[model samples]
Target: MAKIDIRRPHSLSVADARSIVDRVAERMREKFGTDSQWSGDTLTFQRSGVKGAIAVVPGEVHVTAELGMLLSPLKGTIEDEIGRKLDEHFA
Candidate 1:
């Protein structure tokens, strides 16, 4: 399996950051067919070829995931897309 780990720093309040992450989750569900749940300040999501968590802290959001073999080859593309979304949402 391949892994993706990205940490992005933001200036928004915790609640606002989490709300944006939830928005990202909804987009993920629509585009990738994944489901997500929140546990404390972290949101975890899983689908057949991907499993990941997005954690929100005081000044950062951390994203981590493992891609299954079938999806591993596309890691760069996937990571880029995540980065793009992060930029779009949090920039």
Candidate 2:
């Protein structure tokens, strides 16, 4: 498996950050067949070839994921998309 980790600073309140995360989860479900759930301020998600968590805090968001072998080659693309969305929502 390939590992992906990303951390970005943001100015959003925890509530707003969570709203952004909810949108992300919906997008992931539509685009990637992922399922997600929130545990406190963290969102945990998984799909056939991916598993991850996004943690929301007062001034930052952290994301971590593992890509299964068949999907590992697309790690950079996946990470870049996440980065783009992060910037779109939080930057």
Best by lDDT: 1
- TM per prediction: 0.96, 0.96
Q: Please give the distance, in angstroms, between residue 7's alpha carbon in candidate 1 and its true position after superposition.
A: 0.6
Tens digits of per-residue lDDT for model 1, 1-91 = 9999998888999999999999989988998899999999999999999999999999988999999999999999999999988887778
lDDT values, one for every candidate? 0.94, 0.94
How far out, in Å, is residue 21 in model 2? Answer: 0.5
How close to the true structure is residue 67 of candidate 2, measured as C-alpha lDDT? 97
lDDT tens string, model 2, 1-91?
A: 9999999999989999999899989988998798899999999999898899999999999999999999899999989988998998889
Task: State residue 70's C-alpha deviation in candidate 1, in Å.
Answer: 0.6
* lDDT score for candidate 2 against the true structure: 0.94
User: Which ten contiguous residues of candidate 1 have the minimum total lDDT?
Assistant: 82-91
Q: After superposition, how far is residue 37 of candidate 1 from its true place, in Å?
A: 0.1
Give the deviation of candidate 1 from the true structure as CA RMSD.
0.7
